[model samples]
Target: MPSTQRKKIVFTGGGSAGHVSVNLALIPSMQERGFETYYIGSHSGIEAGLIAGLPNVPYTGISTGKLRRYLDMENLKDPFRIIKGVAEAHRAIRTLKPDIVFSKGGFVSVPVVLAASLNRVPVIIHESDITPGLANRIALPFARKVCVTFPEAARHVKNGKAVHVGAIVRDELFSGSAARGRAFCGLSAGKPIMVCMGGSLGSAKLNRVIRNNLEKLLPHFQIVHLCGKGQTDPGLDKKGYAQFEYITEQLPDVLAAADLVVSRAGSNSIFEFLALNKPMLLIPLSKAASRGDQLLNAESFRSAGYADVLLEEDITDIRFVHAVQQLYHNRGEIKARMKSHDNQASLRTVLELIMQTVR
Candidate 1:
C-alpha cells in the first residue's frame, strides 16, 4: 500500500450486462482503498461501452473469440482468435503488473483469466448461474477461487475452490425515492406500477408478449417498460404506460416506484429485484438462445420462493397475465422471504475476498 508501489487490480468480464455489473460494483471500493484499477475486455463488446466512461479505470480492449455450444463458421476461426487474445492479454497484464485479476464469467474472460494464470497473478472468477457457463468452465482450472451466486453452483466447481457468496447487489440501487420515480414516469399513485425489463440487451419475445397484453395489463397497473435499444413502439404510447430504451441514472427511481416486476431471468437482474423485495414473474431465455443458464437461474429463484417463473416456450398472453396477477397476490409472501435473505453480507464477503486475494 505504499505510495511508490500502489496495489493494482485488473477486472475482466464482458459479452453481457450481467458480466460487467459485478466489476462495476467492486471498482469504487477498489479505488477508495487506493488501488490502481484496470479493465480488460473485448474492443467492440458491451463491456467496452460500459467501462469506457468510468474515470480512473483504464480499459484495455483485447481480441476475443466467442465460445459457442453449437457449430458455426466462426467457430473454425475463433480458436486462433482466442490464442491471439491470450497473447495480447498476457502482454497487457505483464505490463500492468496487477496484484490480482477478477473475472465475472463471460467468453471474453477466458483469455484474460488464462493470461493471468500464465503471468502468475492470482485470479478469482464469479459464476452467476447454477452451473458454470462454458467460459467459466474453461477458466475454472486457472482460477485461484471460484465464487458462485448459488450454493448448488459451488458443488459443481470440481476444483473445490468454489464459494457461495450470493449475488453482489450494487449499493446505489437502494438509494431511490418512490416519489421521485413516480414523478419521473409521470405516474399517479392511484394504480400499482409494474416495471418490465428484458435484460440490458432486451428480449424480443418478452417485448412482444408484454406489448400484446398491454391493454389487459394497463387497467390493473401502470407500466414502465425498458424495451431495450430500438425496441420502443411509438404507437403504444398511452396513459399509464411508459417505454424507455434503457435506464441509467434514473434506474433506481424506476425500481423504487415499481410495485411488481416482469423481467428476463438473468441472475443479476433477478437478484437485484430480490434485494429490492419486489415480486417478479421471470421469463428466462430458452435453451436455443443460451446454454439454458437463465432457465436454471429462474428455477432456483422460484424454488427459493423469491420469484415466479414462466418459461419462454410456455408463455401466452393469458398465462403471462395470470402469472403477473399471481405474483401480485403473493407479493407480501415473496417480500417477506426476500427480507429473510442478506445481500449486503454477500457483497461484503466478495469484497473482502477480492481484497484478501490482492494482499
Candidate 2:
C-alpha cells in the first residue's frame, strides 16, 4: 500500500495556452499515479476561465504583468504589483505545501517560483521555447530540474540540471484521423488543406496577409483559419475560408487534416505541428513579442528543414505565395522528416523526473 502522506504537485504559469497546456497535459498522468494537484496563474491572463471549474484541482491567481521595453509612468507602479504577487504566491505555497512545484516559464511563473524556492519547495522549471524567456532565465538557478524543449535553450540556463524533454503534447494530437478531420471541417479529401492558427488567440499578421492573398490561396487549397477574436477582420467573412475565434476542443481534428500549417513560431504550435507530422510555414512575429523567442523558434524550425520561416517585416504577397508553393510541392520531404523526428515521451519523462526529485 502507498504511504498515507499525500503527494501534492503545484503547476504555475499562464498567459497564453502555450504556457498552460503542458500543465493540463501532465494532470491526468499525475492524478492516475495518486498525486494531488494544484494550479497557479494570473487572474487577468487568458488562463483564468480555462482553469476555472476543473475537477480535482485548485486554481489560484496572483497579480502579474510583463516587464515592458520602454519605461513609462506605469513602470513606477509595477514594483508594488510584483511585491504583491510575491506575497500572494508565498501564501499559496505555504497553504499547499506542495511536494514540488512545476513551473512553465512566464511572468506569471516568476513570483510563484521565487516563493516556492524561498519556502524550500522543490521547483522544476520547464522552458518550451528554443530560447528561454526572461522569467525562466531569472528563475533557472533556483530550479532543481530545468526541463527544456530544445537543446538550444540549455546554454542560457546556468544549471547543469537542464534536461531536454522535448515538448509535452496531448495524446489526441497523435491519435486523430486525417479522414475524419477533413470530413468534420467539410474540407475535401482530394484537395490539400492549409491551417493557420496563431496559438489560442490567433495571429493578426497571418490573418491580414492571408486575407490579402485569400483568392490566390483558395484555388489550390482548403483553408482552416483561426483568426483570433482580435484578428478577425470583416474582410475575411467569405467562402472557402473556415474562420474561427478559437477551436479549443476541435483543434487536433483541424490540425491532423491539414497538409500544411501556417502559424506563428510559438513553441506550443510548432511542437504540435511536428507531433502531427504536418508540414509548416512559420511566420514569426517581429521583435515586438515581449521576449522575441518566436523569432528564434521560427529560425530553429526552418534550419531543421521541418518548416519554412518568414519574418513579419519581410513578408509580402509574392514571397508568401512562393513559400507556400515551395512547401506544398515538396511537402513529402517535410512529412518524411517529421515522421523520423520523434519526441512523444516528453510528458512521461518529465513527470517521472519531477516525482523522483520530490522523492
Candidate 3:
C-alpha cells in the first residue's frame, strides 16, 4: 500500500501521442507533489518512445492488442493478447500497489483498467474526443470516474461516472518565446509564422499538400512543419521553410512564434492551440480513415469560431493554399473569437480531481 508520505500513481495510455499527452502534462506536477509515477503501455507503441523522453518514470511494457471493430485474422488472436495483458497488468498493479491509476483511454488501457479493478485500485479515465472511443466505452464501467475534454462526451459514458474536466493543457507551453522559436527554426521574422502539425505519426495527406504548395506559401508565411516521426525531407530545403520530424522541448517556442496553425483536429492539440489563442485551419481525418472523431472535433471548433476547417477529403494542393491564406488573412478576427474560451483552470481541476480520487 502507498502511504501518504510516499504515494504512487500508475498512468496508462498509448497508441497515439494524443493518448499519452495528458499523462505527460500531469506527470511533472505529480512529481512535484511528491508522488512517484509509473507508466504501463504496449512495448512498441508510440507511448513508449514518448515516455522514454521523461526521467525517473519507470515504464512497464505489457502485451496489448489493437481493439478493432472491423474483422481481421489478427482480431481472433487479440483476445488472448488482451487476456495476457490483463494478467501482466494485474501483476504490475499488485507489485506497484499505487494509490490510484489514471488512464487516458486507448486499447492498451482496457487491460490495465481491468487489472486495476481486480486489484481493487481506483481507476480514472480521461477521454479527449466528443464521443468516447470504443476502448473508453468498454472501460467506462470499470472506472470510478471518466474525465472528458468535451462536454458532449460525458453523455456517451453510461451511469454517473462522467466528469467534464475540459482540456488539460501542458503548463510548460505557456513559457514559449517566439524569438527563440524563430532563431531555432532559422526562419526569418519578416513573415507571419504558420506551423503545420500532423499529429504524432505524421499525416501523409498534410505533408503532400504543404510540400506541393511550398512555393506559394513560403512567400507569404514562414512555414514550420512538424511532419511527425521520420517524415522530414532532407533535400527539399527552402528559405523561410523549416521541417522537423517533431519538436520536443522547442514545441512551445515554435508554437509561440506561430501566427497561425494548420493541424489535424486531435483534441489535445486543438485545445492547446485554443488555450494559446492561435488561429487555426483544421483538416480533420476523414470519417473513412477515422471513427469521425477528428471531423467532430474540427467541426466543434469551427462552429465555435475557434478554427476554419477544410475536410481531409476536400483537400487539394490549391485548396490547401487557399485555406491557409484564408486563415492567415482572418487570424486577427479568429484570435479575437478564440479569446472567448477560458482554459486556465483545466490543469488545476484535473490535478485536484486526481488528488480527491486518491484520498
Candidate 4:
C-alpha cells in the first residue's frame, strides 16, 4: 500500500450498538493506518445519533428500517424503501468510490451493500450473530467476504467466503488494564466490580431485572451500570450504582474494573467481555425480536463457555441473584474460561480479511 493512495473503506450498518460498534472498532485503526474511511448508514437509525458530533468522519444517510416479524401494512412500503435506499446508496457509492465496503449486517446496510456489489466494488459482510440476520442472508450471496463472529454462522453463507474473525473491538476497551481501571472507575482496591449494560440504547428488561436484584447484589461487589441512552433517567435505587447513558473514553476503565457482567449477549458486548476476560451472565432477548440473532449469540457464547445465558422470561429475582453470587464466587474459573477464548487482536484479523478480498 502506498502512502499517497489511501485505502478508502466505507462502513455501513447501524440499528443497534451491536452493528455500530464494529465500525467504531475498525475505523480508528483504518484511519491511523492512513486509510480514508467513510461511513454510510441511515439517518433514521441510531447511527446518526451515535456517529453525529464525532470528528474526522464523514457519513451519508439512506432511508432504512427493519422488516416486521409478522405481516403488517409496513411490509408494503419496505420494498419501495429498499429500492429508494439502494438508489441513494448507489449515488453515495459512485461519489465515494471506496476501496472497500465493510458492512456489519443490519437492515440499514442492505441497500448500501447491494449498491457496492452492483458497482463491482468489493462488499464485505460481517454478521455479528451466530444466526445471520434476514437482511444479511439475503445480501450474503453478493458480498465478497462474509465475515462472521461465530464459526457456526459459516453454514448460512451460500456463495461468499465465510471467515470467522471473532469480533472487531474498539481499542479503548481492548487496552484497559485492571489496576488502572479500578483507580479510574473509583472502585476500592479489593472490592470486585460488576458491570451491567444493555447495549447503547439500553434494555428495559435487563434494567428491571437489575433493579429488582440490586439490594442483594450490592453487598457482594460494586456495580457500574450502563443504563443506556435515555433509559437512565428513570433512576435506579441501588446505593452504589454508577449510571451512564454513554461511557466515552472511560469504557476501558469500566470493563477492566468489572469482575462480572450481566448484559445482553449482543455480539459486540459478548466479544468485548471475552477480550477483557470478564465473566458474564448473558440475558438474550426472546425469539420474538424482529430477528432472533440475540438468542443465537447467547447460545454460541454459552456453548463456548465464554458466558452463561439466561432467558429474560426465565429470569427471576432469586435466580438473577443466585447467578451473580455463583459467578462472582467462582470468578477465577469464569475469567479463565473467558481468557481461553479471547482473541484480542480480532479487529486486525477482520481488517486483514477485508484487505485480502479487496486488494
Candidate 5:
C-alpha cells in the first residue's frame, strides 16, 4: 500500500514569472494529495513575494547569485555567492528532509537542485522553453527527470531523463467568465478586447509602441494593457483602453475577456494563451535584454500556427498595428489550431511523475 504519511515536497524556481508559474499550478494538487509543500528561492526575488502569499507552502529564502553569460564585475563575486547559496540550501534541505525537490529552471533553482542531489533527494526539473536555459543546463546532471514543454527540448537533455509532458496551466484559468472579465475591466461587448501583457516585470518597448499606436487600435479594439510594475501611463487615460501595472487574482477574468493578445513570448504565458485559444501577437524580448529564449519561444509558436511574431528591434508603429490586424484576421485559424491540441494533460502527467519519484 502507498504510505499513509504525508509526504514532503520542495519547489525551487524564480527570477522570472515563467519560472514560478508552473510551480503555482501544481501546488493546489500537491496540497490536496496531502503533500506538505515548501519553496526555496532567493531572499528578495519575485518568487519570494509570490510564494510567501500561498497559504500552506512555507517559503525559505537563501542567498543566490545570478548566472550571467556576459562579462561583468559582479560575475566574480557571484561564484562565492553561489557557493554560499549551495551551503545554505544544503542545510535547509537536510533539515527539511523533503521526499523530492521540483525545480522550474531558474538561477535560484541551481543551488537548490545541487543541495537536493547532495542530500540524495530525488529532483525533477521542468523546462518551459524549447531550449533549456543556462540554469537548467547546469542543474540537469543533478535532476532525476527533466520535464519539458516542448518535444524539441528533450533532444538536448541526456537520454531517458527528458519527458515531453506539455505545459502546466493553472486550473483557475479555465474558470474565468468573459462576462465577469468584461465587467471587471468596465468594457462593453461592442468591441473585441485585446489584452496586452508585457509580463510581470513589464516590457517598456511593447508598452511604448502600444501606447503610440493606441489611436489606431482603440477604434477597432478595446485594450487592456498589463504594462508591468511601475510602467503605467498616468496621462493616457483614454476611452476604450485600460492600463494596469499588474493583475494577480483577476488575471483569469482579464484573460477571459480578451479576444486577441499582444504579449511577450514567455513559454508559460504563450501556453496559457494557447490553452485559452487566444490568438496572439508575440513581441519577444530582444537578445540584448535576454538570452533570446523568448525569441525562440515566439518563433516556435509562429511555426506551429499558434501565434504571430514581431521582433522587438524591428517594430515600428505602422508594423505593430499591421501585425495586430493580421493576428485579428487570422484569429479564427489560430483558435482552430489551439482547440485541436490540449496541453493541460501535462499537469496530471507531472503530478504522477512526482508521485512515482517519491514512491
Candidate 6:
C-alpha cells in the first residue's frame, strides 16, 4: 500500500523542453496527491525558465555540463564540471532526503541520479525516445525502474527495468479553448490555423522555410510561428501570421486553436499532438545535430499513418509547401486514425508506478 504521509519527489531534467516536459506533466499531479515536488537542474538551461513559471515548485540549480556526442575542447572541461555537479547533487540529496527521485534524461540528470543512488534512494527514469540517450544510458543501471513512452525502448533497457507506460500528456492540454487561443494570437475564425513549433530552442530550418513561403500558405491558413527565443523577424510582418518567442501558459490554447501542426518530432511533443489528434507535418532534427532520435521518431509516426515526415536534407520551398498542403488535405483521415488509437495509458500508469516505488 502507498504511504499515508506526505512524500517528496525530486525531479531532475533540463537542456531542452523535451527533457523537462514529462516532469512538468507529473509535478502538479504529484503535488495534488500530497507529494512535495522539488526540481534540480542546470542553472541556465531552459528548465530553470519553465520551472519558474509554476508556483510552489522550489528549484535548485547545480553545476552541470552538457553531454556532447563529438570530441570538442569543452569535453575535457565538462568532466570536471560533472564531478563537481555530482558532489553538489549528493549534498543536496542528503539535505532534502526525498523518498524517491524521478529523472527525465538530460545532462543535469546524471549527477542527480548518481546522488540518488549514492543516498540509497530509489530512482525512476522516463525515456521518451526509442533509443536511450547518453544521459539516460549512464543513469539506467542505477534506476529502479525506467518508464518509456515507446514500447520498443524496452529492449534497450537492461535488467528488466523498462515499463511501457505510453505518453503522459498534461491534463490541462485538453482544457484549452479555441476561442481564447484565437484571441491570444489575434487570429480569427475566417481561416484555419496552422501552428508551427521547432522544439524549445526553435528550428532555424523550419522558421526559414515557413517564413520564406508564407505567401503560398497565407491564403489557405493563418500561421502561428513559435520561432524560439530571438528567432522572430521584426522587419517582416504579415497579415495572417503571428510570432512568439516560446510559449508557456498560452501553449494549450494555441494548440487548441491549431487546425494543423508543423513541428519537430521530439517524442514528447509529437505524443501530445497525437493525443490531441493534431495531424503533424514533422521535420525531425537532423542526424548532424542529434543522435537521429527525432528521425526515428518521425519515421515511426509516418509508418503508423499518424504524421508525414519531411527530412531536413530533402526540404525545399516547393516540398515544404506541398507537405503542408498534403497534410491539410488528408487531415480528416489522419484525425480519424489518431482518435481510434488510444494515447491514454501513460499518465495513470506512471503515477501509480512511481508512487508504488516510494510505498
Measured over all alpha carbons after superposition, the RMSD of each candidate to the real structure, in angstroms, is 1.7, 2.0, 1.8, 2.7, 1.6, 1.6
Instruction: Note the Cα lDDT for every prediction shown.
Output: 0.91, 0.84, 0.92, 0.80, 0.92, 0.93
Instruction: For each candidate, give its TM-score against the true structure.
Output: 0.95, 0.93, 0.96, 0.90, 0.96, 0.97
lDDT of 5 by residue, 110-213 (tens): 99999998999999999999789999999999888999998888888986999999989999898998898889888998899999989998988888999999
Overall local distance difference test of candidate 1: 0.91
Question: What is the number of backbone collisions in each predicted candidate, taken in the order shown?
Answer: 0, 0, 0, 0, 0, 0
Best by lDDT: 6
Per-residue lDDT for 75-163 in model 3, tens only? 99999999999999999999999999999988999999999999999999999999888899888888999999999887888888888
List, residue by residue over 256-357, the lDDT tens digit for candidate 4.
777789898788788888887888888887877636788888888787677777888888888888888887777787777766665766777887887777
Deviation from truth (RMSD, Å), model 3: 1.8
List of clashing residue pairs for candidate 5? none
lDDT of 1 by residue, 1-359 (tens): 54578899999999988999899888988899888999999999888988886899999999989988888999999999999999999999999999999999888999999999999999999988898889999999998899999888878898689998999988889999989999999999889999999988888998999999999999999999998889999987799999998887789888999999999998988998999998999999999998888999998899999999999999989999999999999999999999998878887888799888877
Question: If both were scored by lDDT, which would come out higher, candidate 1 or candidate 5?
Answer: 5
Q: Which ten residues in a row have the lowest lDDT in candidate 1?
A: 1-10
Considering TM-score, which of the candidate structures 4 and 6 is the better prediction for this target? Answer: 6
Instruction: Give the candidate number with the greatest TM-score.
Output: 6
Cα lDDT tens digits, model 6, 1-359, are 96576788999999999999999999998998988889999988999998998877899999998899999999999989999999999999999899999999999999999999999999999999999999999999999999988888899999899999998898889999999999999999889999999988998989999999999999999999999989999987899899998998989999999999999999999999999999999999899999989998999999899999999999999999999999999999999999987867678899999889988
Considering TM-score, which of the candidate structures 4 and 5 is the better prediction for this target? 5
What TM-score would you give candidate 2 relative to the actual structure?
A: 0.93
Number of the candidate with higher TM-score, 3 or 4? 3
Task: Write down the worst ten-residue block by lDDT for model 5.
Answer: 1-10
By the TM-score metric, which is better: model 2 or model 3? 3
